[model samples]
Target: MVQKETFGEVIRKLREESGLPLRKVAAHLDIDPSTLGKIERNERTANKEMIEKFAEIFSTNSKTLLVSYLSDKVAYEIMDEDCTKDILKVAEEKIKYYKKVKKLIVMPTKTKIKPYKEIDSDVLTLAEEEAYQLRIGENPDDIDLDVIDKINVWDKSVKVEENGYYWKGEPYITKGKLPANDKPLVVELFCGCGGTSLGFELAGFEIAIGCDIHQPSINTFKTNHPNVSTVLGDVRKVNPKSFLQLLDGRQVDVLIGGVPCQGFSLNNRKRHENE
Candidate 1:
């Protein structure tokens, strides 16, 4: 008998065939690697949004990929629905049935990597634990919104002064400031998804400008901080002089970036020939 590969097994096989590592794939989708691993192992089923992301990243047709692992009845039914929501509904139902039937077993190779739940007791309540397991590095979609609202309400009630998104009673956001009140007007550089800009605002700095290469990150920053000016392009291509021009002749508080570390690493042995 040919051993039936589970949905996760099919996904993992596809991921490997594409020559992409889990970490790279996760980063492309803004997901945690372990969470992706869990999906590949079928420890948890991915939601509609994540499933769509996987489809895009893996370059696989979502309906075709899904049908490969589903029964004929389910496969045909899903082919009819086609939309992500319907596909996810079918996947979830299949996952639920798989769980109840105990027909699915964690593959031995996958078991060696520990589950995410094993390491998170420090920050999660029982409910948050469930939520965390369902979606790593994001608010769990499976969780009831009302329950999450209650938790957020309770968390905010205790720390009313803190201004940021809270996750499981801890701040998912951080704010920072430069020492001394004499620091110059701030312009954020390579400001990823507005984290640094938001931090500057929280620290009482007037964010006059921000810049980033990624369009999505720039758009997100614009959405959150409409008052701040942002230029979207390669930091190197945008002359430092032009960046200062955005400041309208004001001094900069900070500039930050990892200058293509791979470039430095490639020259490491060449430059250190004496060693």
Candidate 2:
């Protein structure tokens, strides 16, 4: 069996075949002579630029050099490892999955969300409609349309979080309007005196519930949102069961809140209500 040559070996062979001295090639490649020698011995790795330069110096195919380099890397990486065949088998599947998948950009947490436009398209499927529910936060339309098409077709593969909407493991695909509602339901956290909830209610959304840490603020919230449920507790400790019971089978059409300023935290040396 003929041994497959490593990238360095192939390049070194080409250099020797051309009768080019090592230092002369190193001068052309802009690397030290020792580095070039190590590369020839395959004790150093070759970068893409160096591979292309090697091809230029030796009049060889750039692709052939690159292929040898990549193959050597893969072989060395998997060599002397347990279950090498299993590693390649799983890697092959992952490579296929990656090739078939588009890289999606995830929006940062705390990204400001724009309310979706009014729903209008007749071609919208139920799956697409449910995907629209995420618009209460981010719309998937903000991402690649081709990627969104795949996501919608693939059962919407998403996880809704307090931080943001995730597609598979990626975050914040925005598009499509919020679900149709005459008065979209609203729930508030860190609801100091229900100011934001009051604004949504005035804008035609129904204030469903509000939670605040201060008894005074909760009382004020009740005064402002007479028909809405009120929870007086740190939002972090609010009972999930009671919270859901307050929803009473109705989905939250909106979640609005304004928490204490960072200045209010004990960590802030000058923290005070004035902040």
Candidate 3:
């Protein structure tokens, strides 16, 4: 069986193999060196898109890179011992199912574990557990109920307390006109739910192509942007040449994206230190 590695270990391994200094890699990717440094240290999780970028820069596969991390190993082992193996196994299966079905799949819960009569009665899932754990909160780690329900509970509780929502229901819009003869064009990366793409449309840009790793989000995007082409895979795995090919003879005016945000959270405080 392939052993799992941590985020830090993989970053260090890739850096060493690339024969490039940290600054050089960061400069090439337009990332701050200190941010890259902390990712190597496993203090934070890189978002899906960024992990793909790292894989591309280092000439490695994301799955191969992810499984080599020690932290992932530790986390898996802990989950297994805590009887959450079934949840992870199921989640992996669901992801596979989505790929095979070529449709959007949503896993809102893990194994169905009912709450005690003396406690709350709700169900949850493994993905939900991880989401709850990753959030900023003051809850003790408890896996009695389903992880998904716990996350919902957390979300609802937070919403009630803050009287806030994560995103505005309304979208931004702009108006413009392109030449009738101008070729329709779009370049999208980390294209989650096509929010950025919508923004481009508001500005009168026609989307020709888009890419993202999340099958569900991509499926939703495809439904909303039926005329646009989409690639259901990591952007890093996409060959730059292939990306160029999608545009054919047309020139792209705007590149839209929501590249990994988690990586920046690690060293955002130190961003101005060297300045």
Q: Find the candidate with the highest lDDT and give its number.
A: 2
How well does each candidate superpose onto the true structure, as a TM-score? 0.31, 0.38, 0.32
| lDDT (0 to 1) per candidate | 0.59, 0.69, 0.60
What are the per-residue Cα lDDT tens digits for candidate 3 across 20-136? Answer: 899987776678888778878876655555666777788888777655553475475666465677767886798785464332223223443333222112433555444433432
- Model 1 TM-score, 2 decimals: 0.31
lDDT of 1 by residue, 25-57 (tens): 889779899988997887866655665677888
Winner by TM-score = 2
| Residue runs of model 1 more than 4 Å from their true location after superposition | 1-184, 258-275
Regions of model 2 farther than 4 Å from truth: 1-3, 103-275
Expressed as tens digits, the lDDT of each residue in 80-163 for candidate 2 is 898989998999988875443322212234554444556645645564555555434556457565664454311223432231
Model 2 CA RMSD to the hidden true structure, in angstroms = 23.8
Alpha carbon deviation, residue 266, candidate 2 (Å): 29
The per-residue C-alpha lDDT of model 2 at residue 275 equals: 38
- Evaluation by lDDT, superior candidate among 1 and 3: 3
